[model samples]
Target: MTFSFEQPPDKLTWYHLGPLLDAEAGRLKYNPEQYTVHGVSNNAVACCWAGLLVDGDGGLVLTDLGRSMLASWKASPVGQRWLAEQAALDEEMSDPAAPSLPAPQPEPQRADQLGLFGAAS
Candidate 1:
């Protein structure tokens, strides 16, 4: 089956990527860091790296790619239909009122953190 830009890469098919996408788009009101993933997830993002990035706090942030893609999609006929759906979703979410997500907190210093294996510091 053909996949749309809204769908994550095949490697990430197992993961529920919509929350991550909505979070990036400011549509999902939840801690973005909670949706954090690395390794394979990073690879998937890399395929379409333009929209997503790891924030300083090890969270995800919507990048220019995300916004641009949405804008582009909204500009097209087919995508405009998708945009209408998204708008409906937005309306639904408006009433339930998910809490607004705050910016990521700074990563704390780990001075006493152990390095590598049995090697002494």
Candidate 2:
């Protein structure tokens, strides 16, 4: 079965299979031997591999094949509309020039016009 962000697998194994087995139901209970059997170098390698799958926007964007599988799922029309509205709201919120409460202006100062700092005048 294809994996996507929308419907991710319960137990995704890559480097170390120990954690993956632990997460899965009816799997051998947290055995360290799973990693050795899988030929995984270390737990850190597994974590790094998982981290690479994450996108810069923090949303888990899948590969072309994954996206194609996700597109097959029938989403509710109302849910799709709500998602669109939320995206629009997010765009407006992130705009730099969005209006805010008026700020008070500070009195302007001239460096050379100060009495002690000024020449004779």
TM per prediction: 0.35, 0.25
lDDT tens string, model 2, 37-96?
Answer: 433334423432443122223222333432333333215464466558868999989998
Q: List per-candidate RMSD values in Å.
A: 14.8, 16.0
Q: Which stretches of candidate 2 lie over 4 Å from their true place?
A: 1-65, 73-79, 101-121
Candidate 1: C-alpha lDDT = 0.47
Question: Per-residue alpha-carbon lDDT of model 1 for 6-98, expressed as tens digits?
Answer: 543333221334534554555543243544554235433552443333342333444554444545555778666766988888887796576
Which residue ranges in model 1 land beyond 4 Å of their true spot?
1-21, 27-51, 56-58, 86-121
**What's the C-alpha lDDT at position 67 in model 1?**
47
Total clashes in model 1, counting residue pairs 3 or more apart in sequence or in different chains? 0
Model 1 clashing residue pairs (backbone) = none
